[model samples]
Target: RAFSLNYWAINLGFAISSAGAGFIAEYSYLAGFLGEALMTLVCAVLVFLKVPESRPEQAAVKTVGGKRPKDEVRLTTVLRDGRFMGVVGLSFLVSLIFQQGYVGLPVAMGADGLSSSDFGTAIAVNGVLIVVLQIPVTRFIQDRDPRRLLIISSLLAGYGFGLTAFAGSVAAYALTVCVWTLAEIVNAPTQTGIVVQLSPA
Candidate 1:
């Protein structure tokens, strides 16, 4: 529930700041960035003040089937595991593609002469679609095997990037963003779940 709380807090804080900015600033972009920075600072302060460490002391020493290993599971062991390393590598590549598309999109749309409203509309569409589709799509795929889901999600992510290569308008860009956003929703939760499952018993 922390994730949901944090998400709502950030969104509400930014919305309020943006509304205030609309009254005080001539340009929306600068106002938005200022709002973001201020909100980030506030979040940092709250985290520093209120958040407690959640790590469990026995996490590394879990005994499986009555056998206690000589050594505790360490960060280095987790990082060195081949499967875990593969997940980290895949996650890095996914993040690169996601960030590049997210950042490059505005430049691409602007180069095509799209206005601020058009870009904002594209983002709105992305947000709306993600909200409406995420749960239903996830529920439909919930019963599928995790490995297959991972593979399919990866392919969908690649397809999203491939679509971006050909996007010439705001609508096309929005479509690509939706595809990638869904891929992210599918991939992220499953990966995290698997990581938790794979932790030493």
Candidate 2:
């Protein structure tokens, strides 16, 4: 539920910004860039005002019980954790497909004779879908097996993102984005939960 709400809010912001960006860019890229900068500043201000500091209230100390407790979990310890390493490796693979959403998708669409506006609208579908489906989907999958969720997410992400190669029109590309966005919603929280479990407490 934590992860679901986090991403739900993020995608809501993305959906609004992405669609608005298209119209803004159509007039002036300068204006688009300025708008992005302004939004960033607004976010910073909001965080400063609303978010409490996470730092512990205790006074700073060089050691706990005369020992470096933080350093107890060493890099070597994490590297030697095979299960954690394996999951991280798999996450890297999934990220490769996701990276294409912002990187290769636009380039490929452009090569197929689509305009910048078309790409914007198509990619916006990704954010919109996440906003709509994340909570409901997370509710359904929250207690299910992580292994099964991961497997299904990987397949859905692979198939949906891979289908973009065959997408010729904006609608077709948007459809492909929807497929992968569902995968994204599933994979994100599931993968994050797995990593948290594997992490050294």
Candidate 3:
């Protein structure tokens, strides 16, 4: 629930800011940059005032090993955890694929003779679906097996983007966005839980 809320806020801010920046840029890029700077300053102030320091209490014992002795989470412990590192490796690969949503998607659509507006319309579906479905989907998956969820999400992300090779229209692109957005919705919060379970205290 906490991670879901965090991700929700991130996507919400992104959606609003992206739309606002587009309009602001139409008038003046300098004005858009100044506006962004002001918003960033405001965010910095809020975080300083409201977000508390989470200094996870750690014992002074400086032991180095693959095994964590009881209620202890150190850098070496996390580094040595085979399962966590494996997930990190796989996540790197997934990220490589996901990045194509930004680069490859636009290039492919442009090759298909779609305009920038058409691409924006297709990508907007991602933010919209995430905003709409994140909370409900989080509720549904909260108590489910995390390993299972991650495996499913990974496959969903792969196949969802894989289906993009066939998209020649805005609607088809939006449909692919919907599929990968589901993967993101499931993956974001669930992956956090897995990390905490396998790594954090």
Clash tally, candidates in order: 0, 0, 0
Best candidate (score: TM-score): 2
Give the TM-score (vs. native) of candidate 3. Answer: 0.80
> What TM-score, computed on C-alpha atoms, does each candidate reach?
0.72, 0.89, 0.80
Error of 1 at 53 (Å): 4.4
TM-score (C-alpha, index-matched) for candidate 2: 0.89
Report the candidate with higher TM-score, 1 versus 2: 2
**lDDT (Cα, tens digit) per residue for candidate 3, span 66-126:** 5535757678778888998988887788778777888898889989998766776777777
The C-alpha local distance difference test score for the whole of candidate 1 amounts to 0.67
What C-alpha lDDT, on a 0 to 100 scale, does residue 106 get in candidate 2? 88
lDDT of 2 by residue, 38-84 (tens): 98999999999999999769655578788876656788889988999
Ranked by lDDT, the better of candidates 2 and 3 is 2
Q: In candidate 1, where is summed lDDT lowest over 10 consecutive residues?
A: 1-10
| Candidate 1 residue-pair clash tally | 0
Of 2 and 3, the candidate ranking higher by TM-score: 2
